[model samples]
Target: MDSIDLEVLKTAAAWLNAGHRCELVTVIKTWGSSPRPPGAMLAIREGGEIVGSVSGGCIEDDLIASVARDGVSQTAPFLLDYGISADQARRFGLPCGGTIQLAIEPLSGASGLPELLARLGRGETVERRIDLKTGAVTLRGASADSTLHVDGDTLATVHGPRWRLFIIGAGQLSRFLAQVASAMDYRVTVCDPREEYRMGWDLPGVELVHCMPDDLVLEAQLDARSAVVALTHDPKLDDLALMEALKSDAFYVGAIGSRANNAKRRERLKLFDVTEAQLARLHGPVGIYIGSKTPAEIAISILAELTAVKNAVPAELLVPHATAAPMSVAGCVIP
Candidate 1:
């Protein structure tokens, strides 16, 4: 599943390649309550066709009409504002007097979109700078922490995978998690030394590795943008991986086990020199406490918690974390 940003990029490239004039619209700023956040993109073709969205449908309709009537006449990038007054908010379908500022640039050879998409295809985070007056563009390497910056006359956006997940087991739950994470644009990897488990795995797009779990976690050079989850439920596999993962810069480290088992795993990690603080970072009872009962539901819960952490939501702002008391069977809470 291609992300909306990727879809916008792809469509713009196609339209430009086909010799059709295209205008790339990016939400640069928002006020009050907007439908989409800044950096959300929409591509408008010379015709009425569009790929992505800016504000529900009303904004897109205006954009398509603007591009079609003007025919990409603006060679340089310009800004457009919608929803300034209460009447305008109702006209553009913005709620609560919302406002959004968009940077609309006519696509050209100088846009550097093809190169930007290529770099993103290589899994490299790229910082794209567009000269709002000249329609010129510059591309540079960006770190995971880089974000979108829109100045008075320039728009710089970050593109690529900003999140990664390393799953320690290649089982049913891992399959669901991998699929969902891929859809969410997370570079996912499932590591296991067991050939039998890997041989039966058939999920596409997710990287599968046949190697020692701990070695993979250590060699992974886990960074703050990464996460590690151990679902093998084996001491030899999960314990070593957690020991390495908890000590790394991974923003989230988790293991699938009961509350008793999670407690036992922490005790084992202490013997391996994992500090109490480091152990505290480990989310033993992984996922928000949703009382999920299936592999897919558990997968959703786990990803929800991971997303909450990614968004830097305070603990008090999030739903209660799930605890592992009684054992779960087939991922369902045993009543």
Candidate 2:
């Protein structure tokens, strides 16, 4: 499963390769309440075929209408604005008269999209810079901190998976979680030293490795944009990984277990010099209490909490199920 932006780029590349004229639209800036954030992309073919989105359906509809009427008139990239007036806001469905600025670049060989996709396939976070006037593009390696930047006439957008999810297990639950996370634009890596658990794991786009969890955690260089989830119930695996993950700058470090097991895990971590502050960052019994009784449901629960943290959603707003309650997953009771 590809992320929405990745899907857009891939579709655009396919259309371009087929000798079709394509135009790529990106949200460069937004004011007030906008439907999409900066760096959101939409790809349109010469015949009005579209993939991905900018401002949900309304703005897309307007773009398609313009394309059908104008017949792809713009030869070079240009900046287009929407919702600048009250009537325009109502027409485009921008909330609170929001104004969005877009950089519409007509795609061709100079766009470097195919090569950009190649780099992304190799798991490299890339910074793509577009010369707005000339419709020329260049690509370079980018760090996780890189963001969309419109400097004068040059537009720089970061592409590829900027976030990482390190899962210390290759079990059934990990498969479901990895699929969902990959679609969410997370570079997911699942590690397990046990051969029995690692066998038959064949999910594409997710890296499955046979290695010790602790060593992998140390080598991961987990930063604020990284998340570590230990789903293997084995203490030999989960505890060691949790210790390393908690010590790193990972925004989220979680472990799946029953309440009793979670308490015991925390106690064990203390003996390894895991600080109270680091231990506090650990999310045990990992996931929002949504009464999940299946592996798929549990995956959703865990991702909900993970997304909240990634977005910096306030704690009170989450209303997380921190309290003890009877929950079961895959017919196994989580007491």
Candidate 3:
């Protein structure tokens, strides 16, 4: 699913375009153990219709109740705090006596949300500055070279698909992985020089590149926030790219292969002077061991693992088969 922030902004823009009244709520700060983080957002329309959430449910209920009772009022932007007391924390389902602060403002044509969404559609990160006092919002394009600062009256929040995936192959598994990654809001790109593999490849929001895998990886210059998956199973194609990827900052670098093949690949990389630490970063036999026999199931397993890593969850807790009881199938034992 798309991030709740993007969904909330898009929903607010649509309501405003349709001449409906809506308010945008953003979580500016949280004290401790809050359900939502600092950038959490929610959009509430005139008739108590909601698009996103701030708290688990209690805070949303409060906002909806306010809207229902008072109707849509274009009041000055204001901050609301919840869970400030022990009883309030218990009532709001907060883990501790954590307090969350929300900035509630009315959405209008002048909010610059539509323009921001357009920029996000072009795979660009845009910073939205909202004036807490005057309620005027401005949008600015952001890049690696951009500088960011927040003042007393201006709040900035980034809105876009912040993750990217580069898959080096267009085979059946790659197709399934691309589909799943796209559903997870990862901007996915597939690179394969073989025409045979690219002949029938087709998917929405996925860029297909007929270029050398290593060259494409270098050109992409993947950052620490990106992921690279080598699925071609060809050393000449996958190995070179993986070597470069390992040297870069991509959060996840993986290759698809059988366990034995993965071991052999590691040995070959060692011969190429790759460090033990770099080799350790490689996730061979990529997905969590889930006994996934079909392509779709395997893709799900891989994406689940990637999601866990992206969210910084412990791998042991994320992999279902890792913690579950061991099982056996077809002369193969799974633990």
For every model shown, what is its TM-score relative to the native structure? 0.87, 0.96, 0.87
Positional deviation of residue 11's Cα in model 2 after best superposition, in angstroms? 0.6
Candidate 3 achieves a global lDDT of 0.81
Candidate 3 displacement at residue 246 in angstroms? 1.1
Q: Which residue runs of candidate 3 sit more than 4 Å off their true CA positions?
A: 144-150, 183-185, 200-202, 311-335
lDDT (10s digit) by residue, model 3, range 150-222: 5788878776656889999999989999987876668889999999999978785689999999898899988
Better of 1 and 3 by lDDT: 1
Q: How would the candidate models be sorted by TM-score, starting from the highest?
A: 2, 3, 1
Stretches > 4 Å off in candidate 2: none
Q: What is the lDDT for 2 in model 3? A: 48
lDDT at 230 for candidate 1?
Answer: 89
lDDT (C-alpha, whole model) for all candidates = 0.85, 0.90, 0.81
Count clashing pairs, candidate 3: 0
lDDT winner among the candidates? 2
lDDT at position 59, candidate 3: 84
Q: Report how far residue 250 has shifted in candidate 3, in Å.
A: 1.9
